[model samples]
Target: MKIKNQIKLSILTMPENVPLARVTVAAFASQLEFNLDELEDIKVAVSEAVTNCLVHGYSNDRNRTVNIVCSIYDNTLEIIVEDEGVGITDVSKALQPAFSTDPERMGLGFTFMQSFMDNLEVRSEISKGTRVTMTKRPQQDLAAAASEEN
Candidate 1:
């Protein structure tokens, strides 16, 4: 896919910064022709990813950092959230619905990310940190879909 536009941001691993990352990515995704509901889904997915980084990845350590990259392609938006703090030891188990390491939380971060985005990929290692890549395409116009060569 040809790149249309992109934005990269690094934010502190603070709970307050979750909204900052969420709104920023949604604004960038707004460049595409996403509907209001689609935009909201994107925002929610972003919030989940960033929240995971802060709460699970960094364990609420304010000194850590989280990185976000939002890229626009011809018909899709790609968002990547990364952290350098402690990483997941079992990515498959972590991806399962309601499987949070924390007993107090609902453990639906990955679930929300998977549902809202068209594609979701997670990479992590015990001490190497985790990276989440999510992509979503705008609802296709009937004519446009018909015209595209498969």
Candidate 2:
């Protein structure tokens, strides 16, 4: 798939940055003419992705850095969240509902990402890092609306 445009941001792993990540992605996604609910879904998915990076990837270190990349294509928006911290040993197990390495977590991050986006891909290696890539293709009506407004 060819990318029409892209933006990349790197921020500290502070909990506060989660909202920043969400809003930025939502703003970029707004170009696709998503409705309020669709925008909210994108924000929630971004929040989960960044939160997972902070909570599990960096273990709340706050000193680490998290990178986010947003790409725009013809009718799809792709977002990637990455962290260089302790990585997951079992990607499959982590994707399971209600499975979390930390007992305090509900382990629904991946599930939410999957539910909100059309496609989700996770890559990780022990002690290396983890990257989450998500793609959302606007519905036909939404795409038509965007073009009409243009």
Clashing pairs in 2: none
TM-score of each: 0.93, 0.91
Q: When superposed on Cα atoms, how far off is each prediction in RMSD?
A: 1.8, 3.7
lDDT of each: 0.91, 0.91
lDDT of 1 by residue, 18-127 (tens): 88898999999989888889899999999999999888888899989899999998878999999987899899999999999999999898999999999999999877
In candidate 2, stretches whose alpha carbon ends up further than 4 angstroms from where it belongs are 141-150
Q: Name the best candidate (by TM-score).
A: 1
In the range 32-133, model 2's lDDT, one tens digit per residue, is 867788899999999999999898888889899999999998778999999988899999999999999888889898999999998999999989999999
Looking at model 1, the pairs that clash are none
